[model samples]
Target chain A: MSSSATINRSSAFSSPRVGQRNWEYATLYIFLAPFAVLTALFGIWPIAESIRVAFTDSYTALSDSPVYVGLDNFRAVLAEPAFHSSLWRTLVYTFLSVILNVSMAIGLAILLAHPRLSRGRTFFKLAIFLPVITPDVASFIVWKWMFNQNFGVVNQALLGLGLPPFAGVTQPGSAFVTLVLVEAWHHVGLYTLIFLTNLQLLDKSLDESAQIDGADRWQRFIHVTLPQLRPAITINTVYALIEFLKTFTVIFVITKGGPNFSTNFVSYYAYSKFNSAQYGEATAIATILFVIVFAVVAASYWYMEKGDQR
Target chain B: MSDGAVTDQARRSAVRATLESTVLYTVATAIALMFVYPFYWMLVSAFRSQEAILSAPLRLIPEHLDLTAFQTIASIGGTPLSSFAFNSVVITVLATAIGVCATGLGAYALYRNPRLPLFTSVRYSFLLTIMYPHMLLVIPLYFVSYKLNLLGSTLGIILVMSLVPLIFFIFVQFFRSVPQEMIEAARIDGASEWQILTLIIVPIAKPVILTATLVAFLLNWKQWFPVMVLSTGPETYTLPVALISLNTEYGINFQATMALSTLTVVPVVIVFVLTQQRVMGSFMAGAVKG
Candidate 1:
């Protein structure tokens, strides 16, 4: 129905605009021409060029002329251990980050959405949401200091309790855990705010209908809340995935993808290679990363459609 | 459940509200402290002398306030602290202006008639922009930026930064919500597409445009990544790049680093707060829709 309407509308403009309609269309294109030109130049062209360059042996960003070497860049990228490990790690990191953020966000939204509870809701919202707006470097510095082993508060409290020392950097697993913890802390605020906004717009009668049917708190949340929250959940999860793919500054300020590259996701690895003056390989990595992200997100959407009615 | 002595139930609810308020306040205060403490620590430490910093690890307040960090910010600066603000301002102003005008135009065009060829492409292109990552073009953009001599200039940054996908993200989403029938009605009265956009779409979508501008500008303004990668000269160093440099130089000096961090962050924070109404409005629209 929507497609036909769209097509019908489009065809009307396309066919015969001999009088006033012609002038309107001309003015419309005149307004849109600059944006279209810029998008084609900066947006589409770079993307196309990047994909094309990925098949070559261009290393440095300073290269003016480079001979194309077919299939070699892809082959090299595939053979790289860092590539494989970072690929797997990106999946794990993105999955853990998205799931935890979305769930916690929903939990927070539900708690704050209770209409009768009139006490500390505003303060809680501010406390959680402030971090979302804090500049990336400053937050990174604070988290880095928090995870510091020597005079850091986390370590101090742990020691006071007679717990064993945690070497956040020297140990591999702990470092990974710390990264996860930091990422989770940093992102939870944004997602929580998103869910809260969603919950506020919701119709109150849906939950009431469930409650009258003898649904307990957990039951109300599962059947009533989750079903109504499908749209929010979809938005939250999808955006989370996009964000996790683009994450750089947090890890850059803290770990720099350190502890022997244990935390080098596809995004960071591309940055690292670019930093190393390897433009050809870096672009290849980026292309691959883009492809990976595009594929995963598409697959998820396809799968979700199969599973859910929407 | 509430029928047993309504007055008693009311009293019980009052008591619960009070208790809940206290608990919530306490919990929130603790969390806020946790979030804000490191910057606080940095501020106090910045005022203390080096020896004092080493001696008193947990000083909540400095016994002697010093201007050493501020002095350092003034004297040892190639890109003065003001320049960072200047760079951010130029980018924010130019980029915001461009984004607002362009989105208004593109959105108006699409909203004027969604079925037009250019308008149809604009719709799909805007959607594509939202999905596409900016980082995908960093390397190629570097080559282009270098070739075009856009590597270090503020104008260069403004031009490219103005090309954000988020602009379309803002506009297209907003344009969709405004009814198309309004445009048709206006057209029926012999109003030009430009006139309809200016008088009708502009006024109705004013909140959205403002929101989009605020959000888009801040996103560009806070970003230091492109500057970090493309620009090498200190003269071109953005606040974020400069902050990173400070971190590298004085990793051990908590006082100067954090003080500078706070100083650099405050303007953006202030802007964020002021424009947050618009930000929240756009977000609410997205949340309700998605």
Candidate 2:
């Protein structure tokens, strides 16, 4: 509240702020200089350079200068068989993971919001949320152990149920499922927390009115609940989609996109190019990814706000 | 009677819910086991003999635990754990301090006038930066870092690694929640912009500032790409990079990997236990209330 008083005081005396001219801008400039320099020199430079690198024949062992190959990099990327396979796989992983993560999070948010579920409830959230904070490498190691083909907990539980022992990591499709499941499990906690928080902000009277109308648990959730949670759904979906697209460390830990390039995404492909010493081609891949990601984020924000405005 | 049938269906629904409650508890425990087991396994595996690791992979129960991995790590690396930890501490501390300050100032500037040049554009860019893949930025950014002679230096890693676009965006959103009258009072005091930012603004944001610090630290501590790119030697490498190297060099030994993994997660667990509320506060503010 004191901040309000201070803010009012400052805007009242706003003019002549910062010593009145370029000569007096030194203090602010000095404070801001470190960030601006670092971002410009490294952050923006790489992004710009990557675009330049994408338009040339930059993939060969013999070429140092990356001969002007105009659109060839894009053409080559599109033509590569693995590129299409990887792209499709990436899309599928992102789609399935986001849908599962967001939906379960929403469901859990509703369940956990029950007033009866109050006592000792914080423990439940912390239990689920622990994985979200676990470092990717460590969490990856844990999941790998759980998905162990023979002796891991998952298989152990399955066998304990008198079911057939599931073979693991030996097939591409099966591994993809395990990977997605692990990713979804790791992330659901964050969304649950997100959605649950949003749910708490809504009008209690609305839920009460529905109850007065003789609504039950499932009805309250579906009608009175779900529609009110759309804003959260939008945020959660955007976050999950971006995160799923950028997933590398987990996959790197589990299968290294293995049994072939079954789980590989564009980011990892870019990493592979760097390791392969095709710097230009690597930069090209990254540039394309940046463009794609940038476009998605921009369009989503534009549309989301437009929707909100209406 | 139709009424009897309706009652029967309701009974069936109640039974189904009881079954679901059982399922929920089971799923919850199973997830907890998955989440918590690695740390326990790490403790056991890190202590057990190498031969034990290979021969008894299915042994959920540890037969015998020893500190051979710990001893080895201690002897050759001569404080690999501590040094890696120390490096992480230094990097995280500086980055967080610098990050929060920038965020506070930027948020204040935007919130005060809302007419700041490119304010909306800045807001949009920060949002976009959340999706910005730093992994993809690794290669190209490495070249720039190399040119700047920042490669292999802690200073370089800290500076370049401090891009907090999301942090900035989140704070701007956070600042919007700060009542406008506070800014007005600060303005009325005839305080300089910096004075208003430092004295009046930051104190109000302490809770979220702490939350943001923890989040940023967790993110940076686990970050391997920039540190991996910059640090050429063991001494300079941060914990995550060192852990990765340990995994490969140790031949994917699960016990050792778990041990190192356990080490990486200790700070988060400790911080979560200590300040979970501050951390959860961020969620509370943004989420819609039920």
Q: What is every candidate's C-alpha DockQ against the true complex, given to 2 decimals?
A: 0.39, 0.36
> For residues B10-99, what per-residue lDDT tens digits would candidate 2 score against the true structure?
999999877877666665556556656656665566666656755655466667666656655542245457788788889878877777
Interface RMSD per candidate (angstroms): 5.7, 4.4
Query: What is the C-alpha local distance difference test score of candidate 1?
Result: 0.71
Task: Give one digit per residue, the lDDT tens place, for model 1 in B50-100.
Answer: 667655556688888887877776622565788876776777778778867
Candidate 1: tens digits of C-alpha lDDT, residues A18-107? 545677789988888767766665566667677767766765335676768887788888899879999888888888888888997887
- The global C-alpha lDDT for each of the candidates, from Candidate 1 onward, is 0.71, 0.69
For model 1, what is the error of residue B36's alpha carbon versus the real structure, in angstroms, after optimal superposition?
4.0
The lowest-lDDT stretch of 10 consecutive residues in candidate 1 chain A is: A1-10
Question: Residue A142 in candidate 1 has what lDDT?
Answer: 63
Candidate 2 residue runs with Cα over 4 Å from true position: A1-31, A56-68, A212-216, B1-34, B47-64, B75-81, B113-128, B179-181, B283-290
- Per-residue lDDT, model 1, residue A37, is 64
How much is B140 displaced in model 2, in angstroms?
1.4
Q: Count the backbone clashes (under 3 Å) in each candidate.
A: 1, 40
